[model samples]
Target: MTIEQEKFSGGVAVITGAGAGIGSGIARRAGEVGMTVVVTDISAERAEQVAEEIRGAGGKADAMTVDVSKPAELDRLANEVFEKYGSVRLLVNNAGIETIGYAWEIPVERWEATLNINIHGVIHGVRAFVPHMIKAGQEAWVANLASIGSFGIMPVQTAYMVTKHAVQSFSECLYLEMELAKLPIHVSSIIPGQVKTSIFDADAGKDEPTSTARHRQIMHDIMKAGGMDLAAASQVILEQVAQNKFWVSTQPEMTEALIEGRIAFLRDQAPPSLHESARQLLEA
Candidate 1:
């Protein structure tokens, strides 16, 4: 069924990580569409900044500080938003952290932090918001941010890759469950290739070994050069979501080839070279 754009007007949209990058881009688009945008972030200042910007541009907006990794905070956010707005029409679980290192070489704390924010954060959002959305009986949607890494392998990024893969799987299951229950809520897995974001600069301020620093530098350079514009990518994502489409891919052609290569490998062909795939993506 085709979803009309008017459905978003006057709707309540809560977006995690709305302080910067892709999240901020999505928040701006939501505001432009006349949605009451709730810009939530771990950084209170940044969240407030985004909320104010939206209001300045003639949209309804609010700011809230929420650490999505914490279930209590997310639950409280849900309660407060529902109390004020009465219902939520969109939930964007976009908060995530990146840990760059081989699976075994990464510190335990880093791995835990990555999983808590990237995977469990989305889980907590679903747990806290789905019930309320159901009770409200409003047409709603959840957009979970995964990555191209969800379907492809990248060396020294095991932690980020693992969590993104989990998000993809979780989103798929959520879609099926909602369909089976005949719920009005829709779910989407936002599988983006690189978008211009500071996520790659995460390791810049860290005191890491020479090799780790070098690796991060290489990644940072590649992404900076090739990543899609944050605004453009966000627009593509929300457009697909408005249509209730799943598999929200930013770079569809590249993503399709990666998935096809994975299938080919599973069919007993020569394993696709991860480095080759990454090189092509970086060049693209």
Candidate 2:
């Protein structure tokens, strides 16, 4: 019933990680408004399933597989969507991963893998697609997935926080830069608190992971403890989007943490303990 809800009708959207969870939820919601959707995921079958679901619901839909960290794959996916629909007015970069461990105990591969998928994936999508959106000369949207972790470090999930910080910074810069260029394309970033999605299983080793994986036993336990329904969270997010809200967030709890952390960072001197932790992790 919001203005944004009224406005999204008849648009064509490209959503990453659209096979399930938040991505599927966004794609389906986009469908409800009669938008042509291109569902993309690393799993081709799952992506196709999401697209088919939209089609089944009497909406325009298509599907593709993309490893978002790879520029070539992202470029191809963009071209395919544009070739069929003429424009990709909305882009949701929602693919990500997380691994949990004590800073010193974390595996370098796990850290790198998290960055590759969680951070660079968004980079690749932006690089391969956003310029074309700028040239399209329409009121477009770019939504990047971030997390509350970017506000402060979660004890065992250092890499996830780091990557989210990168994503948050990138999305913010993009939003400001686009505005400076007088573009109508809107930019938003979602920093979900604890949506009930398989995102918690991001580092679950080697399983198909329809939401059931965690790198660390304790972290997995913490995640398995549970959160809000993915559908419900997605709905909240969409409502925010309809308002041109850039920080589409579900958790009101972390606001203070965000405020305090920045204030402390601004007022404090570098602590030696911080360097020790970094050195221990890097020199291992």
How high is each candidate's TM-score? 0.92, 0.84
Per-residue CA lDDT of candidate 2, range 1-284, in tens?
A: 65545767778888898898889988988887777888899999989998998899998888888888677998898887767777777899998876665656556776667888899889888888887786777788889999877766554566678899899999999999988988887888898877766755544544222222233444445555766677777777777776788988877576456647656766785441333553464344
> Per-residue lDDT for 131 in model 2?
77
Please list all clashing residue pairs in model 1, or write none if there are none.
Answer: none
TM-score of 1: 0.92
* Best-matching candidate per lDDT: 1
Worst 10 residues of 1 by lDDT: 202-211
* Backbone Cα, N, C clashes tallied per candidate: 0, 2
Local distance difference test, candidate 2: 0.77
Residue 5 lDDT (model 2): 58
Error of 1 at 271 (Å): 5.5
Clash list (residue pairs), candidate 2: 198-211, 201-213
Candidate 1, residues 46-120: lDDT per residue as tens digits?
Answer: 999999999999988999999988989999999999999999998999998777765667767777778899999
